[model samples]
Each structure stands twice: as C-alpha cells, then as structure tokens.
Target: MQLTIERIYTKTVDHDGYRILVDRHWPRGISKVNAALDDWAKAIAPTTELRQWFNHIKDRFPEFQTRYLQELEQNPETPAFVTEVAKQLQTTNVILLYGAKDQEHNQAVVLLQYLQRQPAIQALLRKE
Candidate 1:
C-alpha cells in the first residue's frame, strides 16, 4: 500500500508495481507505449467542465480541491477504482500517476488524499 504521486513525464519508471495514470485526458506529446502505465483510471479524474474552470490556476486550487472532492463523492467509478487499488495493494506499491505540471495541485494529489483517508484503503495499507 505504498502509494505515491508522480509526474508522467518523469524519467523514473523503475517502480516495480502499479503505475496508473489518473488523468482524464492523455498527456500531450506522450504515446501510450512511452507511458509505461498499468492502467488509466480516467473515471476518477476531474470532469471536463471542472478542468476547464480550474485551468490549473494556482489561485483556484483550494476551491478546485473542494469541488473535485464533491465530484468524487458522487462518481460511481471512484469506489470501484478504490477497491481495485486496495486489492492491488495487497501485493505491491501503487503509483497514482498524473500529467499535471503542478505537482502539489493536481487531481492525483487530491485523489490520493481522499483515498488515504478512507477506512477501507487505510485497512488495506495497514495490512501491508
């Protein structure tokens, strides 16, 4: 259950476990083959409308986080993704990969925080 967030473009891809892309859209200029990804959980990403509104504006990050969490709460795919990640954690580390340039303000960061706070996810991590 060692979860970490990483930029998709980073040179380090040596991690020996799940490397899931959590972005709604594929990163520009990166090919599927080059991504070295195990999964692309786009359903957990921010909606197109929300992404457009936030536009990575640093000033809007706080509000964006709140809004995104609300979206996640209602998103049916979130639970399934969390279950899947928890199951995977039984055996290996999990990387929630993202394409955002803002390391601290991306959806992956928020999603990671949300997941870490969940009791189910916490139990799984504790087992590891």
Candidate 2:
C-alpha cells in the first residue's frame, strides 16, 4: 500500500486518492467543506487523556508511541480499519491526514509506521 502522511492545513490542495483524517478532534480553523477528507478515522486516535498528557511535548513521544501502539492493538476499530484501508489501497494511494505541526512526532507518523508493520498491510505492500 502506498501510504503517505500530510498535514491537514497545508496550502497544497492537490491530494491524490483517498485521504483519511486520523485526528480524534476536529482541527482548529478547518472547515468540513475545505478539508476535502474522504473519512475520519477517529477511533484509532490517541485517547483524550493521552493527548492531554503528551501535549505535543517532543520529549514524551517515545512513551506516547508505545502507549499509542498498545491502544491501537487493543482498539476494536483497528482490525476493521486495517481491512478498510487494505481495500482502499488496492485502488488508490492512502493519505493519512493529520493536524499536528510536528510531522515527526504526531500520531500520523506513528500510525504510518504501525500500518507498514501490520501483517495485513504488509501483505498488500508486498504485492507491489
């Protein structure tokens, strides 16, 4: 699967294929009409408590990644999300859209890595 990450607020508007927002809460100053999102996978986003604790602190990223991975594995929506993404990937490139300014430490980055490692996702990637 050709998965990529992009900040939601970027000025560039020419996103190709399916774009899914991976944020739990709607990002500030963005409207539904302009976001051009195909889906919002909020179920897999970090919990409110975790998000508040992390507070975008770069130092907390490591622990946050671990905790987030655990949450992804335990989350009921993960399997179905994987399946849906796999289905979509067969037809288009999947863009993981996020609102975080820190491209390196945000959930989208972690999620892209995590998705790359998933057996189901990996199997599809191998086909290419």
Q: Kindly give the number of clashing pairs for every candidate.
A: 0, 0
Candidate 2 minimal-lDDT segment of 10 residues: 10-19
RMSD of each: 1.1, 1.1
Return the top candidate by TM-score: 2
Residue by residue across 1-120, what tens digits does model 1's lDDT show? 587788999886746789899999999988888888899999899999999999999999999999999999999998899898888888888999998999988899999999999887
TM-score per candidate, in order?
0.94, 0.95
Stretch of 10 with least lDDT, candidate 1: 10-19
Which candidate number has the best lDDT?
Answer: 2
List runs of model 1 lying over 4 Å from the truth. none
lDDT of 2 by residue, 1-128 (tens): 48889999999854687899999999999999889999999998999999999999999999999999999999999999988888988988899999999989999999999999988788888888
